[model samples]
Target: MVAITGSSSYNPIITINTTTTINEKLTPATFPQWRAQFEALLIGYDLIDFVTSKHQCLAIDGTKSATSKAVNFYWIRQDKLILHAILVSISTTITSFLTSCKTSHEAWAALTCLYKGKYRTRTMQLKEDLTLSTRSSRSVIEFLQAMKIIAYELAIIDHPISDDDLILYILNGLGPEFRDIAAPIRAKETSLKFEEIHDLLVGHENYIRRMENQLASNLITTVNYSHWKGGISSNDRSFSNMGHRHNKQAIHPKATPSSIQMNLQQIVQPPHKEKIKNGLLTLLHRTR
Candidate 1:
């Protein structure tokens, strides 16, 4: 009987496990996003220790005893298990490179080396992106979010940016709309935190929106007033035209049969004869 004693019940001496399935797996595309989480998982499973080093199972002086052989076999089995777990997390394309690695340590180092180069290149690209970032037509919030993402990626790679530099970059990238706020923040003797700058810029943006709304309201009021005035002017022109027509009718009254009939009736009426004679006399005087 093989005697097994260890602190944990699931120790390799007590139990050699079956297939290990991790909830979170790694792929080439997700390597950057999931690398930290995957590493944490590895640590949780106690498999990181195996990858970090090969466990010494025998005496240094090349001793070949039953105890040493059992210990070596235990180490080998554990290494294989850890290696299988890592391989399961990786994708087929990258898995090919790690297939030849006999020990877990070798596989881990190979993956690290491969990803580290890519990480450095990615870091450089992110740094360049941050340097060239601009607000342009983007909203203040949108611009800040983009810059912060680049900064975050750089920080993850151990190339952290200072808040002062970040503030300066933000100030530089801002469009003309934010100039008033950015100028004051830049003129300050002490460096302002990014949060302070963000608050000021956001406040200014809100003020701008309010002012825009007020201007629009004023414009609408002016347009409506102009339209009302135009309607009144149009009505006045219509009345003026009607008055002109009445004056023309007074100056050049049409000689119709009704006028002749009215004249005959007035001539026959003794009561209208005096008034008709007075009207004729006035007309003759005015014509002269």
Candidate 2:
């Protein structure tokens, strides 16, 4: 492998061409994903040695022939190409890790040591984050996605969280509103997948929202109905009271309709006429 890489005829373009565009750059949280992509790219180009420290740069010495200088030049070029690829894949914030590394092997070594050796610390932190996560005002999907990301981080560190434990963590964080479903999930004898639980929680969330809307609608309807009924009752009471007062005044004996009509007749008829009429009726009776 060293002889082949050191040959003047060997091209480094093969390694450059094999470079897969890493969509997700390296970050503390994404180390595992970044490393997998980078490693695969190196492996595909048969240039894994450049990063693995397997390919040593040919020595350029005063005693060496012109052929040796050609080998050294090509070797250095390939190594630098690999190193540049690594630098570009990493995020700017974390470039400090490779600041002192001059070659591909050094850069790769620095990153591996920093991430793999320090996994324990990151793993513990992620576990804590997962444990303390809550649904809060976020939707069920958002909440679950956050927890799942933590789980994935833990898995990358080889400290995978079991489904049961993960479910328990999720239930604990969902607050009392989801206790109905959470309790049932806890008591189940069969194991459930994360996807299944996610669906169930989302469905329950929708149901809760629907119920709240229904309750609000019902309350508004009840308030409007009561207000209408109260207005009608108030108007009816006012009219009834007014009619009762008028009837009471009109029916009093001193102010009755019959008394008014009799008074009117007494004023209109003359006293002499009534006496003359009565006398004539008596005389007629005597003749008969």
Candidate 3:
């Protein structure tokens, strides 16, 4: 093999692809999503080194050779492209403060300084929100989603909360009806992920709703059946009283067979048909 003269290879020039636009401009409230999108794009292109300061600019002076000048030009061009990407992605409110920043690293650091400074207060507020969250009338998925959003925000601010703590927060916020499920999860020694617990909670919520509906239906059916039976018993009592009174009048001590026959005939012709039929039958049977 031939010996290498200057070097085997040279560092490739890094370039930022400006065609991919960041969807939203940076604002105080939007920093987390905006940072994520921007960072992901930079990372995918392998140009994150510019903003992180891992790629430093070469120095240029009167003593520098043509090769040094060419390298410095390439570095400066790439830096300007990255800086432009950052400036355009920011809102006018924050971009005004970054006007003096000339390099990608400076802009990136400035943004972090401005937003990361508020992490302490923001983290406290997020924690409080998560702690106080309640399911109330909302669906289980909605409740879980709300809590997850707060957790995500916390993570973006560099204050990541554990899954177990989040699970505890969820159990605390749920109604007492969920105690059956909550107790077992609380007692488990093994670590559980959010996805597994999510399915369990949702399924349990549906079961509870079904049980409540079934109980309500049974109660209604019982009340209706009792009412119907009571109506039949009341009518029977009225008919029995009519029959007994007719029979008592017919068996009077001084009454003759003819008089009893006349009383039975009268009983068969009037008022309620069922009561009349039963009353006449009772009188005839007693006379026989």
lDDT of 3 by residue, 1-288 (tens): 111122212345444433455777889988877888888887876778989999899787788977778778777876787798788778888989899999999999999999887778888999999889999989999999999999998887678889999999999999898999999999999978999999999999999877766654443343234434454355445654564465656334354445545654554455666675654344334333
Q: Give each model's clash number.
A: 0, 0, 0
For every candidate, C-alpha RMSD to the true structure in Å: 22.1, 25.2, 18.0
Best by TM-score: 3
Per-model lDDT? 0.63, 0.71, 0.75
Name the lDDT of candidate 2: 0.71
Model 2 segments more than 4 A misplaced: 1-13, 17-20, 24-33, 40-84, 91-106, 231-288
Angstrom error at residue 95, model 3? 1.6
Candidates ranked by TM-score: 3, 1, 2
Per-model TM-score versus the true fold: 0.60, 0.57, 0.73
Best by lDDT: 3
Question: Which 10-residue span in candidate 1 carries the lowest summed lDDT?
Answer: 1-10
Output the TM-score of candidate 2.
0.57
Q: lDDT tens digits, residues 116-216, model 2?
A: 97787887888889878999999999999999988987776678899999999999999999989998899999989999999999999999877866654
lDDT assessment of candidate 1: 0.63
